[model samples]
Target: MVNILPAKEIYLQGNEHALLLLHSFTSHTRDMKKVAAKLHEEGYTCYAPLYRGHGNAPEQLLQYNVYDWWQDVMNAYQFLLDEGYQKISVIGISIGGIFTLKLAQLEQLEQIIVLSVPVEKEPEQLKQRIMDYAYNYKNIEGKSALQISNEIEPFTNMPLDSFIAFQHFIKDTMLHLNKITIPIAIFYGERDEDVYAQSAETIYQQVQSSKKKLKGFANSKHLMTLGRDQEDIMKEMMEFLRMNNGDLTQ
Candidate 1:
């Protein structure tokens, strides 16, 4: 059995307006910490949860389904609500973006910011990514070459139910985009692949939010927050929030 690696879940107390940040697939909350910290510096409460089965062995990832992650998202949102933050927004990237859209469908969110989302189906690529994660993760764990191959070989061609469920969840979220009426800002990196750019356009066109903005950073890519245009994108994000009742100087 793979032991769970320790993860750092961040919560910075600042103001009544809270921001919930979600990370990508095969990632931890650290990916969103920079954005959360940036917002916290401006007097905003920020919480980024480390999802279950993540920050651990890649094999452990296969043990959890999309349902597990959804519960994590719900719990994170509920934590904010219980903290007396009536107004809450979400910023999600990749799989986190998927959750943000799904959350908007049922939750009373103030607004949403989605980055580098893959709204379309990507089962094959996802499967390959899982395999790659497993290989790289074992290497990081200091496992020998024989051990890594032995561990990954069993699941290389096997049918993974978690990934199938994840794809279904994405498709399910796409059908419910019209349910979201809050303001939305979708951003992508010009340096990223065509899939992300197309996904951004799809989200912009499909969400029922009347106030939606779609922007691309010239020097950024899929992981926009860590790209060269990170500062510029964050500035634009703040501006978008300020325009949409995010002037939290209160």
Candidate 2:
């Protein structure tokens, strides 16, 4: 059961600067926990929302789409603003990073930090991962083999609409990248697929923000938040927020 980890939303209130941390797809809010805790220690309030259809049976994830998660992003941001956190920034990894970029398109965020965001789609890889998640999720839930097959049957054949939604969402976010004018920092791990390296480069080139920085973690892969260089990643994230979050001109 421990092989398929389950997680919950986390909130640690500290100061006026609020950080809305977003997690990756096929994952939970726990992906952002370590960094959120680190930022909270620095007096920055942190909130990591578990998007609808997640943190439950993986079959439930198929019931929702990326648009629903976008609404979750909006709600998470609004929650911070309503809590008097006027200066809110965003940090997202993987699909969460796509949402981060999507938010930056329409919102006046203080800064944006994205990790291992896929500008290009890998359909086969995506399919395998999602199916794996569904299988493991059912397996960990103590479901019988028949029960697992029942829940995973839809995913075993072709791409679901949910998968299509992810593909389209990535393309859609790319179209709006030039609209992001605030400071943005893009990070990718070297051990990840070569596509993510290209993804990092594409995001840096396409974003209209003059204050942009790009770096790669030698010791990290797609899940940079939990990699060997995570501490370095945390320091880099905090420094970016400190440097850009204070600027009122943006």
Candidate 3:
């Protein structure tokens, strides 16, 4: 039986190696729970934080923006630091992956694991996609496009101003990719529907990190963290952590 308490951050105590996990936008920390458990089993401490306006009703998300989400990431990182863990690793899925890359530019991380991150899309392209997604819910009874997007969407009912926040983060991260020197492991599913698989190659080519690797999963999708290859993903992540000399000083 699953525990259905109110949504909250997950903190698992383990060895010296600490992992700060971030989930996708509109998603709660629960999405990272399984991966956190796997890492904890390997003697690694893990923390997964719920971003503002998440883990509750979908309508709550409309009040937040990318900055709020990023602040959540920073807070989680600081919490781990306060816990006296020196060596830290970061992992994120989708938008979470984007935040992890951005965070690496600002902090010293042992390594970063990115799964199914989207490439920066052109302005018109993004606008059209968002609009198309909104159209799907426009006709649903008692469910406006925004409300529906808040809950389940390829595009959320996120306002233009809020949506632009994410675009800004993506643009900023792209500019600073050269600043990320830590080892990075990137995973992309070949059949991913949300993000282009080519994004993995683009990221691999732009990062200044000498120790970076990109791997493709033949049978996974955009939600690779919760997909069919989760076990394989976890195995690969464990190997990556080992190869990067993660401080598992238990």
Q: Rate the local accuracy (lDDT) of all candidates.
A: 0.86, 0.87, 0.80
In model 1, the runs with Cα more than 4 Å from the true position are 1-5
| Model 1, global lDDT | 0.86
Worst 10 residues of 1 by lDDT: 1-10
Q: lDDT per residue, candidate 1, 1-250, as tens digits?
A: 3444667789998888899999988888877878988999988889999888787777777777779999999999999999899989999988999999999999899889999998866677778877887888888778889888899986597575667777889999998888989999999989998988998998899898999999988998778888898899889878888889746773
Cα deviation of 79 in candidate 2 (Å)? 1.1
In model 3, which residue pairs have backbone atoms overlapping below 3 Å?
none
Candidate 2: pairs in clash: none
lDDT of 3 by residue, 133-160 (tens): 3343244335655655555553443346
Query: For model 3, what is the error of residue 223's alpha carbon versus the real structure, in angstroms, after optimal superposition?
Result: 1.0
TM-score of 1: 0.93
TM-scores of all candidate predictions against the true structure: 0.93, 0.90, 0.84
Q: Which candidate leads in TM-score?
A: 1
Model 3 clash number:
0
RMSD of each: 2.3, 3.0, 4.6
RMSD from true fold, candidate 3 = 4.6
Ten contiguous residues minimizing lDDT sum, candidate 2: 241-250
Candidates 1 and 3 compared: the better one by TM-score is 1
